[model samples]
Structure formats: structure tokens, C-alpha cells
Target chain A: MTSVEHSPLTRKLSAFVALTKAELAVLDRLHKRRRIFRAGHDMVHQGQSAQTAFILYEGWVCSYKLQADGTRQIVDVQVPGDFLGLRSVLLRTSDHSFEPIVDIEAVEVRASDLLEAFAQTPRLATAILWAASRDEAMVVEHLVGIGRRDADVRMAHFLLELGARLALVGMGRAEGFDCPLTQYHLADTLGLSAVHVNRTLRQLRERGLVTFRDGHVRFHDHQGLVDLAEFDPAYLDQTGPLLT
Target chain B: MTSVEHSPLTRKLSAFVALTKAELAVLDRLHKRRRIFRAGHDMVHQGQSAQTAFILYEGWVCSYKLQADGTRQIVDVQVPGDFLGLRSVLLRTSDHSFEPIVDIEAVEVRASDLLEAFAQTPRLATAILWAASRDEAMVVEHLVGIGRRDADVRMAHFLLELGARLALVGMGRAEGFDCPLTQYHLADTLGLSAVHVNRTLRQLRERGLVTFRDGHVRFHDHQGLVDLAEFDPAYLDQTGPLLT
Candidate 1:
């Protein structure tokens, strides 16, 4: 396997702990075996015993549960640098299905190998645990979005969150991010109908707060959006010192 | 500090990993300093620098975020053995407020002391991580409830979930559990109006599916309720081997 000079895992881990060269080498080796999946591919299915955890090297993946009424609720959106199945590694089964919204490049790390790595490298383990906690924080934030916020505020909050997460990996600018998700995905995520999502998007565009076109979202007034959504980035835990 | 015979923290940790007598002794010692909080008291407030984590030894607590519009979203319902502020310990601030739902007995473990414990006992650390992951899983499940399910299904699902969780700690019976939350809390949790929640509860009661009286819920048909909610316990991760 050809080694990449820099990986998103390295960038993400560095945010939690200053990885030594040796630590980086171990991460690089773990992520060397990359696999690509096309859009709409179910990378992991619910109830399946998950044996491997994937590191999203590129593109978007979403974890969602399909309800009895046939509607889906996306639990988490995975971007580059996100570990897809860290919790599954401990839980042993996938509680939700993971699928790619776009063509995705991911590196598969066997559960045994990851556990071994965690045992051998405490710093790396701390980073992984930090990542897991951050994921829980994000889920809680999203719960607030769906449970308390209205459609307009939910859309604003969702876009601002996506932009912030993307900016962490140097993918998006302060004002915008590449958003490949359609109105259907937004509907599922925000607990609104697709029609409602479309109307809300139009309202946001008319207000000059946000604009989505050509698979990208541009925030005309980032602060305006933030204010409308009551968005706070502190929950993301990005500004903290390295745990180690 | 008074030493107790057994603690919910020990029971919860033992589910994740087999605790040696020494580890159990440490946990018992950590939980010796019990604190009491009255109903409606905030255990940990949002935006506050959380210096400690609490183990819910008795009664109920909830972590919630208050919206700008004066509404609230209950992010998680904490039961006995639930670890609050584990994430806050890493993030340096509480992302959500934790409040007691009833007069509560809790063990306050300082964040620094918990970290020291983790450093000394990797097994204990792993158990905490498992607990965090379980919390995330519950949040994700609640997301699905609010995002996709109707009010009736949501209520059923919530009740069934509460029952299962309570049963884990030997609190609830097979058919029902003690439900101290009012319709207002249920409305907040399910993203419905209080009136709607009350009406739905009436409907469920009239249908002979469930009955709530004197702060206790009795399910006439557990399987019937589960079917309506499409509730699956696999997401709870109860069957997994302890992570020793």
C-alpha cells in the first residue's frame, strides 16, 4: 500500500494530542489499506457485528436508522477525519446503518488491531476516546436541533455545523462549505418533510443568510446564521488543549 | 465520607468489565462522598466549568439544553449508575445542564480525581468510555424517536426504553417502571406540545396498551407496546461480553 504524506486521521488526532513521529507512523500504517465506496453504498448495516472501524479519508458518510414508517433519521454525518465505528468496536454491533452520501475513501482498521494499538499507545487511545466523546457531544447538539429548533433554525444550525466541521479539515472556508447532501437528507436529519426543507432553504436564501447551489452552501452572513441558529462551537470541543 | 455496601457505579462498571475486589474498593471509596440535591435543582449548569463528575446513586437526573425561546430539549435521562460530566471533564465546560428530576443521592467525583483513577486503572477508564458510548447510543435512539416517529410511537418507545434501563438496575418490572416525569417533560423529550403529550397518553391508556398512575406506568402488553414503537433492544448493547 502506498503511504500518503498526510492523512485526515493525523490532522484530527493532532487536534487531541500532539502525535509523535512514531505515533504518526503507526496511524499511517493502520490507515494504509484504504477502500473506496460509491455513493449510496451501505458501508455498515444495523445489527451486524462490526469487525472493522473505518476512518473517513474523504467524502461524506451518514449513520441513520430507518423507522417503521419507512422514514430515516440521520444520527450523525461523517466527514473526512471522522472515525466511523469507534463505538461499534466496543459495542460489537452496529446500532445504525452507515452509508456514503458521495463517493467515499475510507481506511478500514480491524477491531483487534485498533484495540491492540490502543493498548500499546495510550496517547492514541486517549485521542480515540476524545473523538468518541466529541461524537456524543455532536449527537446531543443534533438532538437539540431536531427536538427544540424550528425548521429555519434547524437548517441554519445544520449548515453552520457542517461548515465548522469542514473547516477543521481545511475543506471549507469561514463562510461556506461543499454540501453534497440533498433536501431529502436535510429532511431526514432535521425531521422535516423534503418540501419543508426546500421551503426553508428558500427562506434562508431570501434572507441573505445562506445560499446553496452547485452542491455547496455559502453563508452570506455567517454571524447572522449563527445568531439565528443560536449556534455555539464550544460543544465541538475544538478549542481545548490536547488531552495527554 | 461514609462507605456504602454497593454503588450503582460499581454495578454499571461491572457490566462493562469484571472489577477486581481492589477496583471495587476504589470505586466504593470514590463514591463514599455522597451529595444530595433536591428536585428541580441544577446539578451541572450549561456553560459552567465542570470540575467534577457525578455518579447517580439514587433518584433521577436529566441533561438538557435550554433553547433561546425558553423551551428545553432533554438530551439524556440519567439513571442510577449514569456518569454525568465525563465528557465535560475532557471538554473543560458543561455543554448541557444536568438537573435532578427528584430528590437525589449522588456521588461527586472530582474531574482531576477521576482522571487520576483512569490513569491508575485502565479497566475503570474503559468502563467509563463504554458508558459514554452508551449515552451516545441513547441520544441517537432518541433522535430517531423525535425525527421519525409520531407522538404515540414516541411515547411508547420512550416508556419501553425507560423500563428497560430501569430494569437493568433492578428498578422496574417486566411490564412497567416508575415514571416520575410529567407530561411536560415527556413533551420536551418527544418534541411535542404538552397538550399533545397528554392526549397521546390518554389515547394509549384508553387503548389498554399502557396505564400511568401514581408515578408508575404499567404496560398491559409489553410486546404490543414494543411492536408499536418498533423498539429493538440491540441498540442498548446489553448482550455484549464485558470488555475485560
Candidate 2:
């Protein structure tokens, strides 16, 4: 494997690990069983016995749990390099569902394959665990947003964090990023009503912080939003491979 | 190591792993460096560089993040079997603070020791990872409760989940358990005010479902509370070690 084989997973992991050539070869093999899933449909459902995990390479997906009242709470959105259903694969069941927001390209990773890979490559396993920790950190941050922060700050923080994550994989920037999510998605993700999401976005736009329209999230005042949300990237920042 | 040497951690991990005597010996090594932390003080603070983690052997602690407005959200409560600061230690920093609700007994585990332990005992590593997944699952459930469920259901679900976790370590039961948390802690945890928590408890008690008074939670109608909260223990249930 060479530089030509560099991928979002490789790139993200590289931020933490100085991967060897052999490591790259193993990672490339893991990416072999690629598949495409359609938009607006579930790729995995809550409570299903999970046999295979996924490494998302392209497009967006939202992991959510449906309630008896017909409402859903989007736990986290998956972009390129995110491993869908990986956490619960070892646990034997999926606690939530993953719905592709658009056509998605992902590699299916069986449990045995993943375990074998972990056995063969300790550094790569560490990097993967590091990524999982980041995912959990994002969820913790989301918990803080919903439990403590106000609606406007929560919305701002959510957009800013999304941009930061997308930036990791070269899909976004601090200024703005193209987003396929609608206000309804925002409402579900932020624990706000559809009307409240609309008003919150309007308020943010008026304050020159950010705008969520035209299928894009435009950050008019990136620093302002960060200040308003008290957004910190320290948790998401992995300086180098600590495993060494 | 044998059944006589079993501790809370051994008990919790045993649910997911048939740990060998050799593995149990290594797990016991991790139980060294035990310390006692006083109540009403933080053992780990947010944003601090974390070098070591702890295995809670006894007592309770709350992990929380403070907002700029002098408000804090209790992310999760740690019981006897909980692993405090374990998640963020490898990541290099603590994102939340752990304050003991009562005097706590814990065993300090350094990063090097934990990594070495993992290398020496892969099965125990897998079991530890399984426990971490269970912790993340609880956080996800908490997210759902805050994002979707009403105040009453959220409190009921929160208490029931706490009972379930404590029961795993032989500290709680279906009827009730002693709790050290105050109304302020409940307010922070449930994303409600003290007034709201008081009212919610009163309502539950009036309906003969539960009571939170005199530092104890008495479940008068356990089944009724479970039904009201739509509580599911499947996520927390691990029949046996999947690693083997």
C-alpha cells in the first residue's frame, strides 16, 4: 500500500498513529467488502442481533432510537470514517437504528474479521479504540447540550461540532459545510420541536453566528458561535499516537 | 484466584466473561493502590490531564460537567462497580469531574499498568471493553430520556436504571435501594429544577409507584414504574462472554 491507498479511516487514524506499510495493507483489506445503502431507509435497526459492523466511507447516516410515542431521538450522525454498529456488535445487539440520509458507501466488517485484525495489529486496534472514544465523547457532549445548554447554544454547538468532525475527513471547513440534513433532522437531533428548530436557526442567523438553509450550514461568525456555545475541541483533539 | 477472592469488579465482569484464574490474578493486580476519597469533593476535575483511572470498590460518585452559568449536569452516577475516569484516561484528558457523593473506596490504575494488563490478558481486556460498552449504553439511554421522555418518566427510568446497575454489584434490588444523592443532584441529573424533582416525587408517591425520601428509594409498584418508563434491560444483559 502507498499514499494512493490513503482513506478517511486511514487519515483519521493517522492523526493518532504513524501507520506502518503493513498496517496500511491490513486496513485496505478491511475496506474490501464495500456496499451501498439507499437514503431514507434503515441500514440497521434497534434490538437486531448485530453480526456485522460498518466503516462508512461516504454520505451521511443518523443513529436514532424510536419511542413508543412515535418520536425518535437522533443519537449521533455518522460521516465518513465513522464505524456504524461497531460498539454493539460485540455486545450482541443493536440498541438503535442507522438510517442513511443519502446513498451511502460502507464496508461491512464481520466480528471475526475485526477480532482477527485486532489480534494481528495492536497499533491499529488502539487507533480504532481511540476513534471509538471520540465517538463516545461526542455523545457525552451532546448529553451536556441537551441537559444544560439552552436551545440556541445547543443548535450552534451542534453545527460547529459537525463541522469540526467533517473537517477531520477533509469534507468541511470552519467557514461552512454542505449539509443534507433538513430542519426536521435538526429538531430530532437537538430535542427541539420542528418550529423551535426553525426559530433557533433564525435567531442564530440574526445574530450572525450561523445559518442552516439551502442544504448548507453557513457559519457567518464561527468564533462568535464558539464563544456562545463554549465549544471546546480538546476532547476531539488527539495529538499523536499515545499507544507508542 | 478463586470464588473467595471475588470483588465487585469480578462480579460485574463475570457476567460477560468466564475469566480464567490467570486472568483473575491479573485483574487482582489492578485492584492494588487502593485509596479512600472523601465525600463532597472532586477526585477528578474536567479538562485535567488524566494519567490513571479507578475501579470503584465501594460508595457512590457523580460525574458532572459545569456550565459557564454556574450550573452543572451530572452525566452519570458511579456505583461500586463503576470504572471512574477509565474512558478518558487513554484519551489524555478528563472531560468531566467526579465528586464522591459519599466516602468512596477505589483502586487506582495507571495507564501503563492498564495497557500491560491488557497485553497480558486479552480476555479480561475484552470483558473490560464490554463493561465500557455497557457504560456507553447507559449514557445513550440517558440521552433518550432527556431528549424525549417527560419529567415523570425520566425520573422513574433514571431510578430504575440506577437500581439495575447497583443490583449487578449486590447493592440494590427491585423493591428499593439506599441513595446518597440529594434533590439538587437529581435536578442536575434529570435536567430539571429542584422544585420539579420534588413535585415529580410527590406525584409518584401519590400514585403508589415510588418514594424518594429519608435517603432511600422505596418502589411500591415496581412493575407499574417499569411499564411507565418503557424500561428495557436487554442492553445491560450479557448472558456470557462472547469472546470465547
Candidate 3:
């Protein structure tokens, strides 16, 4: 419960809304009960009653649904500072399961405690709603990419998006980031096969647009990738007022 | 502003939380401006500043994103009782556009007025949050379907979900529902070509588990179709308590 002014969650929330010192202290205190999970660990399972919300302090996690045919669809990827299970606080049970993509550390916050904080500070509630709305917008954009875009465009868009999101928290440069995802993870997220993902990555490499190697992706030509993918960051809604 | 107790919006809110008589009156007054649009009309366009929210009183509308290449991705289909632009009120501009699939009647509620209502009634605010959470959950499920399921299972799951949602507002039965979407709409929503959608429909008809023709769908064997699709309604969160 020490000073969390420089924490990733603080940085994320400050981007949207300015919080009072007391408010930050409250949030820091609320985000307690630190836990760690190894890669491939199910942080939460589908059909499970949602009792806790987690804030990723480090590493990556994915929320996905497993089909009857044993295939997985990664609905979303969580980076540092992203709040997991915010929506689950309002629902009875989780609709999708969550798994750690790599070794991870997270703080478990009680849903009731978070709701109480919302009641105490309406601005925090609005910020949470804004975050949720942006999440929905990103999901919609991902749907468009998966539904219409070719593998090349999809991979480019995905890489550019990851770079931008990581940059928001000062984690990556404009053209590159430390990507921990494998071809299988990309396949699950982009609705492509592992082979297709590999081929798409090769095509991008051949075109001199991007490179994915050693768990990192570096864009040689960011604008070219953006143009090829028709990637627009407006859907992220990062420029909106924090409190409205 | 007269008695809206039995209105679709009222029913929708009631399903989540109990509303007092005074709250109902306030909601009725807020939902004052009524408007109508024909099929294929865009109710809200991308990049538009969302100043108002709309409640679909009748007919169907879809929120979609139209790519530069002219392909459309229907992100969500709205039936009666669904609130539009709840998220838009928080964001600067809409990321996706909305269009009506059939002639639609909607009641316009000012975003400022809705905010006022939320400030006055904390329970109403929680209910709205709950509704928004459910919307996000549905979008995530749709993502899973598009990303993982094949054409047949996807179609079956889509139809059953529509039937269940329509049944919520007393618009359809367990075994049948009036469907206004064309094969083109189905194709756009499911990420398939129009020809593929047609072929899939034919396959389902040939299987004798479901019949969709002339804007109507009858499930001859509801359980059979459900089993085939592995459709589960828990993601819809329809059975949760109306109020926390």
C-alpha cells in the first residue's frame, strides 16, 4: 500500500483522468493480494463465478474461449496496467477464460471493494467505464480485421496496434516492442492457422516492412505497415477527456 | 412521456434491476423524441460525435464498421430494448457505424439527460453498467464464434442466439423467430461470403434441423441445433439478478 504514483496502473489511469493523491492511494491500497502464475496457467475459467478482479503488474495474459472442437479463440490480450475482470464484476459468471501468456504477476482486487470505490469516487467509475468502452471498440476493430483483412494486413495491423498500446505505457518504441507471443498465439488471436501465421510473417519480412524474431517485432517501415494494414488508432479513443 | 412501463426499454431494465415508479416516469420522459428509419439507412456513422442515445423501440439495427475496400463487418445486431450509444457518450466519436436492417423505430434520449438520470439514481446507474457489461460479453462471444467455429456451427449458434435474444423481449418463440436479415447480412456478420452463406443455409435446411426462409426461421429440433452449435446462453447473462 506504499506510494503507487509511478505504477503502471497509475500511468494508465492518468492518461484518461487526473486522480487526486488520496484517490491514487485508495486505488493502490485496493489493488492488494499479489499473485503470480506461470505461462499457460488459467487465471480464470469460463463458467466460474467471478469473485476477484486482477490488475496485471507485469507480463501478458489472454482471455479466450475454448470450443468443443478443442480450438481456442483469443478474444483479447492484456498487457501491463490493463485491468482484468472489470466487466465480470457486474456479471454473475465469466463468459471466457483467461490464461497467462507468460510468467506473470497480478494484484487481485475484490469486486465488492472496487464497486465501493466507484461509489466513493464517481470519477473513478467514469474512468472504468471509459476503459471498458475502449476495450469494446478495440474488439470491434479486431473483428473487422479478422473478418475482412488478408493475412498480411492482419499481421501488420496487429503488430502496429501492439506497438502503440505498449508505447502508451512507455514500454516500446514507435516501431518495435518486445513481443512474447508465438506463432500459435498469433494464430489464435488472428483466426489463422499456425502455418498461415508463419507464412504471413515471412511475407512481411520479405517485403521489408517488419521482422518478428526472438520474441520481438521491429517494424522497418511503420508508415508502410500502417498503410498496408489501413490501421487507424482512432478506434482506441485514447484522446478523449478523462472525466466527462 | 406517457406510460412507458411496458416499453421495451422498461422491460430490458427490469430484467436487470427493479425500477421505482418515479424512475420509470423519469425514463419515459427522457425517451421523448421518436424517429424512424427505413432499411439500409445508417442510424449512426463512423467518426460522428455522439450527442444522443437511441433506444430501438421496434425493428432491427446493426452496428458495423465499413472498410475502405467496401466490405462491412456487422459488429452487433440490436433488437428492441437495446440501448445504443451508451458507450459513445463516454468516447469522443463513434468507432463503428450503425444501420437498420428493417424499418426501425427508435426513441432518442439526450446523453446529457441520461447522465442527469444516472446522477440522480445510483441504482439506475448500476443497472446501465450491468447492461453495458452484458453487451461487451456478447461481443466477445461473437469474436470467439467468428475466430474458431466453422460455418455450420457458427450459423447455428448465431440463429439460436438471435432466437434467445428475441425471445427476451417477447418477440419470438423457443422454436421459431422472425428474421429480417438477408444472406448478405448473415455473410457480413459471420465473416463469410454471400455465396458461402447461401450454401451454409442450404446445408442446414438439407439437414432438417432448421428452416430459414421468407424472413422466418423455425427450428424443427431445437435441442438438435443447440447440440450441433454447442450454443450456451450463459454468456448472455440473462438470468443474473436485476440489481446488485
**Residues A83-147, model 2: lDDT tens digits:** 99876666778888999999999888887776666666666666676677778788989999998
Q: For residue A184, what is the lDDT in candidate 3?
A: 92
Q: How far out, in Å, is residue B80 in model 3?
A: 1.1
Q: Give per-residue CA lDDT, model 1, range B173-198, as digits (tens).
A: 99788878887788878889989988
Q: Is candidate 2 or candidate 3 better by TM-score?
A: 2
Residue clash pairs of candidate 2: none
lDDT of 3 by residue, B1-244 (tens): 3678888877777777778888787777777899988998787789898866788899998888899989889888999989877677677777878889889889987656765666556566666777777788888877887888889999999999999888878888977999999898898899899999999989988998899999999999899899999988887777735363
Tens digits of lDDT, candidate 3, A1-244? 3566777777777776778877787777877678889999798898888756788889999988888778888888999888787666667777878899899998887756765666566566666666777778878777888888899998898888888778777798976999899899999999999999999999899999999999989989998999999988876766634453
From the highest TM-score down, the ranking of the candidates is 2, 3, 1
Per lDDT, the best of the predicted structures is 2
Higher-scoring candidate on DockQ, 2 or 3: 3
True lDDT of residue B177, candidate 2: 98
The parts of candidate 2 lying over 4 Å away from their true place are A1-5, B1-5
Best by TM-score: 2
**Error in Å for residue A123 of model 1:** 4.1
Q: Model 2: per-residue lDDT, tens digit, B130-194?
A: 78778888889889988899999999999999888888888898789999999999999989999
**Global lDDT of each candidate:** 0.80, 0.85, 0.81
Two-chain complex of model 1, DockQ on C-alpha atoms against the true structure: 0.54
TM-score of chain B of each: 0.94, 0.96, 0.95
